[model samples]
Target: MLLDTPVRLGIQIRPQHVSYEDIRRAVLTLEDLGVDILFNWDHFYPLSGDPEGRHFESWTMLAAWAEQTEKVEFGALVNCNSYRNADLQADMARTVDHISAKGGEGRFIFGTGSGWFERDYDEYGYEFGTPGTRLTALAEALPRIEARWEKLVPVPTRKIPVLIGGKGEQKTLRIVARHADIWHSFVTPEELAHKVSVIDEWAAKDGTDVSNLVVSNELQRRTTEDADALYDAGVRLFTLGFDGPDWDFDVVRRWLQWRDGKN
Candidate 1:
């Protein structure tokens, strides 16, 4: 388990209602806090609480973050798979991969999923396909993504870690077992354990060891007991999110201390 004892920590700094300066400050603080990974959402606008809220582009910011932070790994929490061509996505990731490889120390965690936001589709002039169709697109694109990664000139500094975030068991977990280095999902701890069991079962049949997978989830509310419980369930990476870069280091610092104590 990644966080079983010395759990790795992550932060999702979703820029909502805050300016770019504050966001930059938050990122720097997270780097200082020793958060393992930093993430941002991929939508053009806000997803919850406010429809007309401040937001930033995901991959563009990630590119900047790659150069800005030397310590923490960074990526989109979940890039909508439907937006970009698979080859294009691969190239973008490769570029960021190299940019972040300060002195050959690259840590770009590529996270993505089938998109679900209709507003993004409508506003961006993309086809709002059905869920099944979206998943099918993702399925077809994964291979092309991998192929492009292999062929991209000056390949990623290291084997870029692929993180797939989703909750669907049958389809999503299956894909995770096949291609992902880290599989992120959302649910209660009980549900998470069950899903892990199913993912393990799939892995056994596929001759893949999912145990090496870094299980991750976003923490909307933080708690010590719950954090420990998640760790006990073989979840190593715990992510806490703050919107608009209100930049509160207290929660991040607490988690860091917790991680140190566990170590």
Candidate 2:
């Protein structure tokens, strides 16, 4: 675990029950407020509130964000690997990576996962396979995604960081050890510690080094003490999510203060 890493803050702007205009404003607001990363989830419909509420596609919104923001790094909090072809996903990520560049490297993080949410799969006509199958597919897809990135013309501005989100010790942690640049999970400090150890063990087995894998976790309902404990346990990136209709900046402001204090 990289315990000495400086603390960074991220915000997930949930794209449910909200207009694109509202999302646009929130993106700008978060960037202006000095957030380290800005994320949105990849889902066809709203995750919470009215199930059939206003929603938008994730990659399209991300392309828009790539052009709109100048400073903050952004991407889907965790893109469902099953939703798109791995090669296409890589090409799209590369294009957005170019789009986000401002006289330098792009600010896109390729956060992805095996995917849950049966509703997304069922409604979209994708096969809702068993969790094991989905994870197996994800494991197969990641290397292809990486290879595709290399083959793409005018390759990505930087080695786009891969942030894998999950806490499963068997498949997910092993995948994290093999491929991830960062690992995101929602777990207690003790659980995080155990998972980190598991990841380290997997890294050894796979002959990969995860010594610099940035540990990430949510901060939505956590107290400062909780944040402190997580930091001690090895988390460096803390993300807080806000759902729309009415997005709250006050909470963001407080967390920004907390982040600044840590740095």
Give Cα distance to truth, residue 98, candidate 2, Å: 0.4
Give all TM-scores, in the order shown: 0.94, 0.98
Candidate 1, which segments miss by more than 4 Å at Cα? 1-6
In candidate 2, which residue pairs get closer than 3 Å at backbone N, Cα or C atoms, i.e. clash? none
Question: Using lDDT as the measure, which candidate wins?
Answer: 2
Q: Write the per-residue lDDT of candidate 1 for residues 77-170, one digit (tens) a residue.
A: 8899999999999999999999998897588988989999999999999999898899888988988998999998988888888888886878
Model 2: per-residue lDDT, tens digit, 1-263? 67678899999999999999999999998899999999999999888888999999999999999999999999999999999999999999999999999789999999999889999999999999899999999999999999999999999999999999999999999999999999999999989878998999999999999988999999988999999999888899999998875888989999999999998
Compute the lDDT of residue 189 as modeled in candidate 2.
92
The best candidate in terms of TM-score: 2
What TM-score does structure 2 among the candidates reach? 0.98
Residue 126 miss distance in model 1 (angstroms): 1.1
Off by over 4 Å in 2: none
**Candidate 1, after superposition: displacement of residue 93 in Å?**
0.3
Per the 3 Å backbone cut-off, how many clashing residue pairs does candidate 2 have? Answer: 0
Q: What is the lDDT for 95 in model 1? A: 95
